[model samples]
Every structure is written in C-alpha cells, then in structure tokens.
Target: MTGTEPASGAAHLRWRPAPLAGLRAVAPVLVLLVALLVALAVVDPGFFDPERLLAFLRRSAPLVILAAGQYLVIVSGGFDLSVGAVVTAGVVVAAELFNLAPGLPWLVVVAVLLLGGLLVGVVNGIVSTVFAVPSFIATLGMMLVLQGAVFFWTQGAPRGYLPEDYRMLGRSAVPGAEWLPWAVVVLAVVGVAAVLFMRSDTGRTLVATGDNDVAAGLAGVRVARLRILAFALSGVAAAVAAILVGGFTGVSAQAGSGYEFQAITAVVLGGVALGGGRGSVVAAMAGAFSLQALFTLLTLLGVSGALESAVQGVIVITAVAVGGISWSRRATRTHQPVRESV
Candidate 1:
C-alpha cells in the first residue's frame, strides 16, 4: 500500500513504520542472551534449573543495580569512574563499622549506607564542578584515592568482615533457603527508587542538563545542583549495592573491582547515550540483567574466568561504537540547515 494508506478496514493492514532503531539497539542483547542460553544448555542441561538460575541472578544483582545508578550520571552529562572505588569504599566502611568496639547496632548500618554514599557523592560532584575537572579525570583520581585509602586502612587487604546481619543483604546468610537473594531485593528496592526519581522533576532536570546545560540553566534548571544530585544518587546506590555484593562475595582487596566499567557497559547496551541526555531507568536495569546473562552464559560454557575481562572489554567497545554511530546520524539530521540560492 501507499504511504497514506486506505480506508478504515484496510488502514489497519497498512504497514506502520517499524521501530527499527529500537529493534536494532535491542537486537544484540537479545542475540547475546539467546546465544548464552544455547551455550549453557549445550554445556550442561542442569544449568537450566530455576533455582540455580535465580541464585545466579542474585550474584549479578549488585553490578546491575550499580549500572542503574551510573546511568543517571552518564545520562546527565557526567561520568562516575569513581563508582567502583565508591563501592569498594562502601564495603570497607561497612566492615569497619561492624568491627568497632561493642559491635554497632543495626541503625549504624543504615547510617553508614546513607552517610557513606552521600560523602562520596559530595566529593565527586564538588571536585568535578568546582575545580572544573573533566569527569573522567576527576573520577579516575577519585578511584585512585579510594583504592589507596582502602589499601592503607587494610594494609593491602580488607580489615574486617560484614556482620551476619549486614551479610543478609548479600544473600549468603540465607543458607539452605531458596528465597529471593538479598542482593536482588536490594537491587529491586534501589532500582524502583531510581525509576521513580527519574520520573520526578529532578530526573527531568538531570536529563535536560545533560542534553544541553546552557539551555537547561537558562530555563531555570539549576544545572549544578542537578549534576551534584546525580553523582550523589549514584554514590548512594553504589553503597547499597556494595552491601549486597560484599555480603555475597565476601570482603577482599578486590571487592567491587572493575564494576564501574561493567555498569557503564550495561547502561550503554540498554541504549543510553554515552554523552548523556537520553534513555530510561528501566532500560538501564534491563541492561544490567542482560550483562548478568552474558556472564552466566560464559560461566556455563566453561569459558575461563580470565576471559571475562576480555568479554567486558569487547562489550564496552561495541556499545560505545553503536552510541557513536547513532550520535553521528542524529547530528547529521539536526545540523543540516536550510540553504537557498539567489
């Protein structure tokens, strides 16, 4: 049929413009998931068991949630390379708190979550904004600082362990029970909160600022505040996720290692723009799940754990390339101004 199409009954048959870009963006992830499942099934049929799979997800929950948090900062025109360090710091802080004399109460744990996250967020936001440092450099420095501090505190190892109470957040405390992992629960809670936050005025402001800070500021969007909040929110979310991860994996010098890249890759795979100002929180979370699936598939395939880093590197490159191509296409469309001849 012609583009304008026919009368009532036949109009329904007229082809709608396909969601081609959306489909394309989603396609790789879907293919990857399918490939993973096939590989897993072929490797070991027992890998398909629901219980084992759920447990697997529990393990992935923290990284996925961290991805959701990083999406906010990146979409709002900033990077948070410090997230891996922030998470490591968070776990260390939690462990230290629990190690204190007289054994701290549960309230101290809650306070630690809130306070630790806010502190890190504040530092990231302030350093980036006030010093006018590029987020990449700022966060990179922050990561080093954190790593050094953690090392100094622990003397090259994590000094303490999460108490049984805090460990419950990680899913290991459940023991023989098959209930939802605490990591998943924490992810769900933070993930839902992030979705809601993105829907609020602050969220919109963050996106607007990311898209064009000059325009957003002229429109009364408090650009600096929004950016700071973005980093802070990310910091807090990382803290919460750290609890789960630390509990699940147990404390080590490597706790929360290399997670920043994982989270960023997940966000990009979910279709968030790299330079910011586009995408959804839900999609970001979906990206997290997709990453987890990829890792799981790799594990099932008997791929060496050593290869996981290589796989992550490949995913990051592919996602960034896709984002760049999309940006070029959009820029081409938008910047082609009208011209006239005399």
Candidate 2:
C-alpha cells in the first residue's frame, strides 16, 4: 500500500498542469472585453440597457462570425485574406442574381451566395495546397480576382436591393422581444457551432497540423485536406457575414472592403497564434466584440472615423508583437538545458 501510494502521488504530480496554464489561453481577451465593457458603461451609462446591448451584439455579429471562421484557418496554420472579397462577392452576386430574376426566392439566392463562397475557398485551398502557392499570395490573388470581377459586373456601381425577407435576418427583431435583433440568433447559432467544432477530433487534428505539419503528417493527420477545409470554412463564414452585412448596410461595391484586416486583427487580438496551433474560437469572438466596442467608444469620444484604419494597424502590430514574444519565451523554456546536481 505504501509503494502504491507513492506511485499514485508521483503520477498526479506529473500530470498536474501549471497554475497559470489554463488562464493563459483565454485571459487576455476576457480582460480586454471586461475593460471595454466598463469603459463603454462609463462613456454611456445606458450602454448596458437590454435593448441597446442587444443592438450592439447584433451590430457586432458579422465580424464575430467572420472571426470564428478566420480562427479556424489561422489555427490550421494558414490565412484567408480573400474573405473580405468573398463577402463582397457574396453580396454582389446575390444582388445581381436577384436583379436578373426578381422573382427568385431569397432562400435560393442565399444558397447560391454560400456556394459561391465555398467555391472560392476550394480554389484557395487547391492553389495553396496543391499548386504550392503560399496561402498569403493565393488568397491575395483571389481577393484581386474577386474585386475585379465585381467591378466588371457592376461597372463600379452596385445595383439592386436585397428583398425584405432577406434583410429580416439582419434587421428584424425576435417575435417575443421586438427590440432584439434577429442577428443575435444567427450569432448564437454560429458561436455554438464553432465551439462544438473546436472541441471535436478534427479540430484537434487541425491544431496539431498547425503546430507542426511534418509531425502531424507523420502521425497520419491529413494536413493538406485540413488546410483546405479551413479555407473553405473561412469562405463560408465570409458568405454568412456578407448576408448580414448586405441586409444591414445594403449593397455597395465596397461593402466588404477592409473586413479581411478586421477579421485578422480580431483573431490576433483574441490571442490566437498567428502562425497557428493556438487560440480559442470563443476568445476570437470576444475579440470581435471588443473591437466593436472600441470603435463605438472611439466614436463617442469624437475620434475621427478616418483614423479607424490606423487604429486597427496599431492593434494588429501590437498583438503580433506580443504573441511573438510569448512564443519565444515558451520556446526558450522548452529548449532550456537541464543540469544534474553533482
């Protein structure tokens, strides 16, 4: 019994996690969110009112969804720079299709937009994985392609209006809580799905691939396929975001412009590793909320809207720098030499 007790104690000690390990993964984003909320409350005492809060969530939903999708790709060791273009394409294509056939059902139009986004993702994956193009370049080229196609199709001017039924997803309120936006429902669904997906085996495998593709492949993980899947998911997310954006803001040639950076920034701010293999989808979503809150605060403070881009640039750079430093410290600790006492 004494021998067994010692063995069990040793095993327990070996298996125990570091005190701060769990907190390290998610604390930054949570702290940022709380801080933002406090600041918002201070800036506008009514910011926490149920109606206003729900409206804020609704406004932030599209970016949150986009961040979720971006999280998948980034955690898989790739970037999806074309997502903004995908959003624009989705909106433009849907509008043009509806213009061509005004009688087309909104559901059908949505399906087409989703498929188009998926197709773009597939191409991105193939180009990056199969053709050996770097993800950054492949997605960038795709962005240009999509932008050019939209410009040609619209001749620099987008036309047609999203049907009321289509707009309802973004603008309508719930039946019982008329003040609550339907977008909250969409955001909830996407958030739950993202959380579940990350907890699944495939998600773990994807993270493994991101951490070290060579090791993951040797362990029988289908790295290429997972990368492609990540990009595809990102594309689908952009499409979903586009639906909400189109419905909420209506269509424009620049409807999705700069959203790619915003999604990336949000993901980084959430503490997701840039080169992949780390971060939580929930944190990434919270990052999105934080970003929106920051923007709102800035607006209230009378910050120029034109400086939004500059602020985003600073956020991205800071997040990346911090992540890099953290990674280096971890790596140093991992590779530090051990000495035996004489």
Candidate 3:
C-alpha cells in the first residue's frame, strides 16, 4: 500500500501542468496589449470613449483580419509576403471591373476578388511545396509579380472608383448601433471564425506539420494540402481587407502598400513562433489592436509618421528574439533530467 501511494503521487505530479503554464500561454501579447491600452488611456483619457474606441476598431479591423490570416500561414511554418500585394490587386481589379461594367453588382465583384486571392495563394503554396522553393522567396516573387501586374494594368496610374454600395462594408454604420462601424461586424465574424478554425482537427494537424513536417506526414497529416489551404485562407483574408480598405479609403495604387510587413509584425508581436508551431489567433488579433493603439498614441503625441516603419521593424526584431529565447528555455527545461536526493 505504501509503495503504491508513492507511485500514484509521482504520477499525479508528472501529469499536472506547470503552475505558470496558463499564464505563460497568454502572457506575451495579451499582457502587452493590456499595458498598451492602459498607457493609451493615460496619454489620452478620451481614447477609451465609446465613439473614439469604435472608430479605432473600425480603422484597425482590416489589419486585424490580415493578422488572423497571416497567423494561419505562419503557424504552418510558411510566410505569405504576397498578401499586401494581394490586397492591392483585389482593390485595383475590383475598381477596373467596375469601370468596365458599371452595372455589375457589388457582391459579384467581391466574389471575383475572393476567387482571385485564392488563386494567388494556391500559386504561392505550389511554388513553395512542389517546386522546392522557400516560402519567403516564393511569396516575395509573387509580391513583385502582383505589383508589376497592377502597374501594367493601371499604366502606373490606377483608374476607376468603388461603387457606393461596395464601400458600405468599410464605411457604413451598424443597424442598431449607428455609432458602431460595419467594419466591426466584419471583424467580429472573422475573429470568431478564426478561433473556431484553430480549434478544429485540421487546424491541429496544420500546427503539427509546422512543428515537424516529417513527423506530421508520418502521422498521416496531408502536409502539402494544409500548407496550400493556409495560403488560400490568407489570400481570402487579404481580399476581405482590400474590400474594406477600398470602401473606406477609396481606390488608389498605394492603398495596400506595406500591409504585408504590418501583418507579419502583428503576428510576430502576438508571440507566434517565426519557424512556426506556436501562437494563438486571438493573441495575433490583440497584437493588431496593440499596434494600432500604439500608432494612435504616437499620432496624438505628434510623432512623425515616418517613424512608423522603424518602430515596426524594431517590434518584429524584438518579438522574434524574445520568442526564440522563450522557446529555447522551454526546450532546455523539458530536456533537463530530474535528480533525486542521495
């Protein structure tokens, strides 16, 4: 009985999660987000006012959506550098389509944009997986290709305007709460979908593949398909974001410029591992909020807008460093042998 009791106690101890594991899982980005929000409130008390907050949410929605999509590709151990270009292409193509067929319905245009985005993603996935190209290079090439195509199509000056109805998704007010932006509704839908998807079996397998493709393949996960799917979802997200941006800001060649880095920065800030296999969609969204809040605070403080790029670069570098360090510490702890007293 005594021997059995000791064995049972040891088993229980081994089975229990570490005391700080829960906190650790959410700490990186969640804690930063809270801190940033508190600081924003302090800097500008009105920042938390309902109207201003809703405005902020509206402005941040597209990037938040982009971050969610980028999260999927990143967690699967791939980068989607072409998403920003995808956004630009979606907007430009929609505008061009509208110019050609002024009577075309907004919903049909949106569907076409989504399909185009998916096609772009499939190309990225195929180039990376089938052609043995690194995702970074493949996506980068895709970005350049998209940029050139848009330029050639527009002859260096984009033409056409988004229809009023098409802009509603980015600029309209909610039915019950006029103060709330329609972008908020879209953001909510995207957020919920992302959370649920991440909890699914396919999502788990995708993460496993990111962690170790060889092992995941051995376990029967369709690694290539998941990678392609990740890119496809990312493309769809960019299209959605483009629709909102086009509506809110109107058609412009540079409308979606630099969004790729922003999404990547937001994802990294959320504590998603660079090489993949770690992160939460919720945290990535929170990171997006934090980033937008930081920008707002900076603007309120009268900082030069030029510094935005520098700040983002620093955030990406710092987040990657911190994540790598944390991973190393965890790996070391996991491998360290337990010792008994003599």
Candidate 4:
C-alpha cells in the first residue's frame, strides 16, 4: 500500500496544471484587454482619466453584472433569454410605479425592482422545470410577454424617470476619487460572492448536476431544485442590472435591448461551456470586462453600432468552438495554454 502511494502522488503532480497554465488560461483575454487599453490610450489619452474610467465602469456595470448572472445559469446547464426582457420589465415597472404614485419613496421603487425580478424568475423556473419546457424556449416566451407588456404600458413612450438619488447607484462612486463607481463596487461584491459560492458544497453539487444530471441525482443532488435556484439567481441579477441601467440611463422602451445575447456572448467568451458544467465565475466576469473593452475599442476605431452584433455573432461561434473542441483538446493534449476553459 505504501509503495502504491508513491505512484498516486506522482500521478497527481503529473495531472495538475503548471503554474503558467493559470496565466495561459487568462492570456488571450489579458492580451485583448491590453490591446484595447493601448488603443484607447493612443486614440484618446483622456480615456485613462480616473473619472472617465470610473464612469466607463459605471456604464459597463449592468452588462458586466448581467454577464455574471448569465454565467451562473449557463454553467449550471440552462439558458436565460428572459433576462433582457426582465431588464426592460424592471425599468418599466419602476417607472410606472412612480408615475402612478408620484410620491412613491425610494424604498418602494427598490421593492418594485426586486419583486419584478422575482416574478420573472419564478415564472421562468416554473415553466422550465415544471412544464418541461426548454430553458431557451421558456425564457424566449417570457421575453415576448414582458416586451409586449412594456409596449402596452408605455404605448411606445416611457414616462417617470428615476430620481437623482436613486440614479446614484449607476452614477455615483465611493467618496474618494481613488475609489471606483458604486456600480463597479456592487459588481465586485457580487463577483466575490459568486466565487465563494462556487467553492461551497451546494455549488459543487450544482456543477455536478450540470455535468451529469442523472449521475448527480443518484449521488443525492437535487438537480431540478438547483436549476430552479440558478434561474432565480439570474432573475435577481437582472433586477439589479435594471436598477443600475434605469437609474443611470433613465427609463426607455429600448432599455434592455439585446442584453440577453450579449450576456451569453460574454459567458461563452469567458470559456464557459453552453451545455454546462465547466467555468469559473471570475473568468466569466473577466470575459465581461474584456467584451466591454472590445466594444470601447471598436467604437474608438469608428466601427458602426450595426456591425457590433455581427462581431458578437462571430465571437460567440468562435468562442464556443474554441472552448468546446479546439482549445479544450489543446488544453488536454499539452501543457500549452489552450483557451482557458479550465
């Protein structure tokens, strides 16, 4: 037995990723991030202004936060098309609540935000898990419903802007200029929580379920409940994002347009598998920052907004292919850095 222990120890060391492997996983993303920073600095040196960078983070916060939420769902074996709609729903609901009751306090508005998101999540979970609908289909339906409701409520024109105090979440930062935007801070908090969650027993069970539901069930993981929890978390994230977006940008019919796809794109870009069971929340957040940096770079380079979607489409396809097959195989076959799917 003691002799066999030596072989097992050797095997562990052999399989363990090298120190550089960590750097390799993050290298591509880091390179892109750096390239964007360099270009931004070249095109507009003011881009490096502390205030401007903080503002950019504030603006990017919603998408970044949403990407983290989307990561949880995707890594846990589900899709969440409803999040885009939920964002719109949240903004519209908050605005309407205030419009109908102009004297509504900030607390009420915050409550509305939370409640709106909870409802969407519940519906998504019930429909997806209980009705046996695919998450994609389920969320798609929710998106349409929310969109139509917004249209009907606003009649194509939104009213009741969020107050300045409420808007501070998206626009304000810590007291010191050295500190970043509040939105960025919130994102950091959520990101840290997510990372810790991933290290917990429940998180492991959830990942196990994503990897193989049938096997996890036999191992005593409540696969369905975990999936529901994942959806609920996603809905909550959307609500938080809505608060930031609406507060910062104001109420608009187009508030959450295209967010769902973008969140998915960011997740895939971070090397998280679409089908499930493989990813790090930190990497997922990095993917979000990387995407924002890419867009900022593109805009600075004079790329049309219309071209953005096309670029994103290419990214999604390329990222998935890299993570699913090419990079993964490379990561497995050699110590060379693959695509950070690890």
Candidate 5:
C-alpha cells in the first residue's frame, strides 16, 4: 500500500478551486461586450460621443435592470417568466393610478409599484416552492395572470399619462448633474448592490442552494427562503425596469412585450448557467450592454429590426449548449483522481 500510493486524505477531501477563480468567470462576457462596442464605434463613430453614449446607456438601462433580476432567479435554479408581464402591469397600473389621483406624488407611485412587485414575487415563490409546483410553470402562470389583468385594465391601450417627474427616472438627467441620466445613476446603484450582495454570505448561500439544494439544506441553509428571496428580488427588478421603460419609451400595452426573452438572453450571454449556481452579476449586466450594442450596430448597418428576436434566440441556444459542454468537461476533471509517487 505504501509504494506509489495516492494520499488517502486527498481522496477523501473534495477539491475546491480558490475563491478568486470565480472572478474570472466574467471575462468572456466582458470581452464580447468590448467587441460589440468596438463594432458599434466603427459603424457609427458618433455613437461613442459622450452625449450619445450616455444616451445609449440610458436606453439600455431597463434591460440591464431586468437581467439583474433574472440572474437572481436563474441562479437560484428557477425561471421567472412573469417579469415582462410585471413590467407591463406596473407601467399601466401606475398610469391608471396617476389618472385617478392626478396629484399623487411620484414617490407614492414608486412605493406602490415596489410593493406590488414584492407581492407578486411572494406569490410566485409560494406557488413554486410551497405548493411544489415547478417554477417554470408557476412563473408562466403568473405571466398569464398579469398579462390578462393588464389587458383588462388598459382595454388594449394605456389610458393615463406618466407625469414628467415619474418619467424622469427613465429619461432625464439627475436634477443637478446634467451629465448623468437617472437611468445610468440607477444602473450604477443596482450594479454596486448586486455585486456586493453576491459577495456576501447570504448571496453565497443562495448560490450554494442553486448548486445543490439538498447539500445546502444539509448544511443548514434555508433553501426555500433563498429561492423565494430570489423571486422577490426579481419582481422588484421588474418593477424598476417598468418605471425606466415607461419613462424611456412612454406608455403602451406592449411596453414590456418580448422583454422576458431578451433579459434571459442577456443573462445567458453573460455566461450565467441556465441551471444556476455559477456566474457573475457584473457579467450579466455586461451581457445586457453587449446585447444593446449589437442591436444598435445592426440598426446602423441597415439590418431589419425584426431580426433582433432571431439573434437573441440564436445567442441563447449557443450559450447554453457551450456552457453545458464546458461544465461537463470541468466536472470530469474535478472528479479525476490525482496520482502521485510516495
């Protein structure tokens, strides 16, 4: 047993990579984003001008915010098909509320939207986790419910107007900082918070639960609660995105149409695993930017807008397939025994 035997302890202990290793996971998405930006600059150099670039970021903010929320749900091993519907509902509801209460402060409207989003998320969580329903089914049902409600409420078109201040969040610059759009500022805030959250104990536990719920539960992690939190956060993100979209593009029944797929595509593009447990929030947001850049570049090149959805579909399928292969290979390497001479 002593001659060239592998270490017994090495065989017993699971090998884990260094914490810093995870940081590199975002590199690919960042590279892709940079390339897209470069292409955009080549197509329309004016696109890089400070004012135009800021404006571009302003437009990209809603999708970026949605991607952040989707990242939470997807990373927790669940899907939130309701976020797009939530955005539509939020915008329509807010407009209606303002119509009824013309003097309602924008802050009040914000609070209501956030609370509603939270409520929707909790329902999504309870239905999926408590009732043992699959998250995909639960969220899909929620999407239908929201969409129906929006249609009934709006009667095919939004009936109310969003006040200037309310719309400012999506379109205007900070009151005193003319150089910064509110959307950019909000994006910065959300980005910082998400990065910090992912680095925290709770965030790590959430990731662990996504990686392996049984193992995380055994380790004393509250798997259900975390998954619910993921859904709730996703809902809040949808609400915020709704506000931005409403302001940026104005009210319409289809304000958030197709956004769910776009957000998912952005998340996948950022290298986030569809099944969850491995990805960076920064990368997810970068993926959103890259997506927006690609669209802009296409437009500059006279590509038909109808092709956006097709591009997203292709990107999603490719990213997921490549990720599956990469993960399979890594698993194989990780499980292989280390041989050594004693």
Candidate 6:
C-alpha cells in the first residue's frame, strides 16, 4: 500500500486506546486496589456502606497525605525518613504549646506546627544537599534527634489535650452534612492541590531534576532550589498529617511511629521509581489506600500485628526489584540504535 492509500479495511477505522492506556504508571496499583476493595467487601459487607467508608477514609487521610508529600521527595530523587518523627514532634510541640499557653488559639498552634515542620524540612534539605550528606543518613539522623528531643521533653508521656476545635477536624463531620468528615475534606483539598502542582512548570521541572539532575542543571533548572522546595513541601505535609492524627487519635509519643516506612511503601507500590523520576501523585495516594485496605483485610483475617512491619518490608523490596527490572528494560529499548538498510 502507498503511504496515502488505505492498506486494508482496518485503516478505515480509528483505533481506540485501552481504557487504562493513559494510566500505565498507575494501572497495577489501581488493579490491586480494586481487588483489595472487592475482598474487603466480601469479608465485611458493611465496609462498603457510606458511614463505614467515611470512617475508613477519615482514618486513612493522614497516610494518604503523607504519601503525597513523600511522593514529592521520592520523585525528586531523595527520601525523607524524618517525616514520621516530624509528625510526632509536631503533635508533641502543639501539646506543649497549650501547656505553656492554655488559651492559645488552635489556628495559631497549627501555624506554629506547620512552620516547625517547614523548618525541619529545610534542615533535612540543607544537610542532604549543602553538606552533601545522603538523604537517608540525614533524615535518619534527624529522626533520631527529633525522637530523642521529644522523649526528653515529654518524658515519654505527652501532656495537655488538643482543644475541642482542633479535635473536631479529625472526629467531626460537616455541620449539615454529617456524612462528610473534615478530614476527608482536607484530603480532597490536599489531593487536588497536589494534582495541580504536579501539572505546573515547577512540578515538571522537579520531576526532570529527579530524573537527571545533571541534565536539569545544564538546562538551568535550579536543581538545589527544587530539591529543597520538595523537602519543604514534604515537611509541611507531615505537619498537616500530624494535626489530623492529633485531632483524631489524641496526643501520644508514638502517634507518628512507622509512618515513614508506610509512606515509602505506598509510593513504591504506586509504581514510583526509587531512584527517581516517574509516578503520579494520585497513584501514590491510591497506594496508601491499598496499604490501608491490606491491613484492614489482615486484621479481619486475624493476622498478628507484629507481622505488619514484616509485610511492609517485603512489599518495599519486591516493588523496588520489579520496578528496577522494568525500568532497565525500557531504558535498554529506548537506547537501542537503528541500523541503515544496505
């Protein structure tokens, strides 16, 4: 057939892409999430009910928010292992604030917590970039430092209660619409903002920097600033998560424990590359939901809580291995040279 002529009847019909063609990065996790949801429905039919589902979402909001923040850092080619500790520290600090100033407004306390988290993120970025310390080591050290400080200050027992207005965000619903929890509202807002940010020029540049800093730098991407911006946003996310946690579950020294790993695993499961550059923010949040579902299913099946960490470790390792192989093969094909016909 000539270039301009129809080769066959097939040429007359326009090819329609698969429903999930545009969602290649998130397809696996989406499928997994659907499967998990189905299983949960089967095991506990009430889970699909509006009230129960809203309650579940209320509980899942913190982790989903964390995953979104973690997505920023991971996509920027770094880790923020200190976020969990940031959450803990945020809550403890807020409680201490109230102890020192019993009449302080909740809004002011939230602002302080957010500022503290931002400061922590700045420190993490500076240590990782300015001092040339690896993010892993830097964040891990930060985690230890924060944990130690919290323990020292609180003596393993946090004092003061979160004001009623603050707790309402976590435990209450909209005034007229009891069906909608404030936590869900916050999650929706955060999710929308994350999606919008990912579509912006800065977000695209951040991904490019994560994918290849040297190339991005050559293109005048301001790599260091972007990385720091990413860490700063992550810190802010952890703070927001802390507020939600403190509101819902009350203050505790261990409120934010294990969250860092959970966030990492959720991002990995969402098909985000560990080495950097790739994955959707929405998918990362979905990963958090999937992880939460998996845990819920496990609990229904009477699994031991002790195995939760083990399960997370296995998920992280397996996801990284699989993603690595897939990325390697794609890279190989992309770099393959074309040969001229003799």
Clashes of each: 0, 0, 0, 0, 0, 0
Q: In candidate 2, how many Å is residue 149 off?
A: 0.4
Candidate 1 has its poorest 10 consecutive residues by lDDT at 333-342
Q: Go through the candidates in order and give each one's C-alpha lDDT.
A: 0.73, 0.81, 0.82, 0.75, 0.82, 0.83
User: For candidate 3, what is the lDDT?
Assistant: 0.82
Please give each candidate's TM-score: 0.82, 0.88, 0.88, 0.85, 0.89, 0.87
lDDT of 3 by residue, 143-163 (tens): 999999999999988899899
Off by over 4 Å in 2: 1-22, 315-342
Cα error, residue 162 of model 4, in Å, equals 1.5
Model 6 is weakest, by summed lDDT over 10 consecutive residues, at: 333-342
Instruction: Estimate the TM-score for candidate 4.
Output: 0.85
lDDT (Cα, tens digit) per residue for candidate 1, span 193-299? 78667656688678778877889889888877788888888888788777777777767778888899889878877767666776666667767877887777777
| lDDT for position 313 in model 6 | 69
> What are the per-residue Cα lDDT tens digits for candidate 6 across 89-127?
988898899889998998999999999999999998888
Candidate with top lDDT is 6
lDDT digits (tens) for residues 181-266 of candidate 5 = 99999988888788777766788788788777888899999888898999999999999999999898888899998889889889
User: Model 3 Cα displacement at 140 (Å)?
Assistant: 1.0
- How big is the positional error of residue 187 in model 6, measured in Å on the Cα after superposition? 0.5
Predicted structure with the largest TM-score when compared to the true one: 5
Question: In candidate 1, which residue pairs get closer than 3 Å at backbone N, Cα or C atoms, i.e. clash?
Answer: none
How far residue 221's Cα lies from its native spot in candidate 1, in Å, is 0.5
Q: Give the Cα error of residue 199 in candidate 6, in Å.
A: 0.5
Candidate 2 steric clashes: 0
Q: Model 5 scores what on Cα lDDT?
A: 0.82
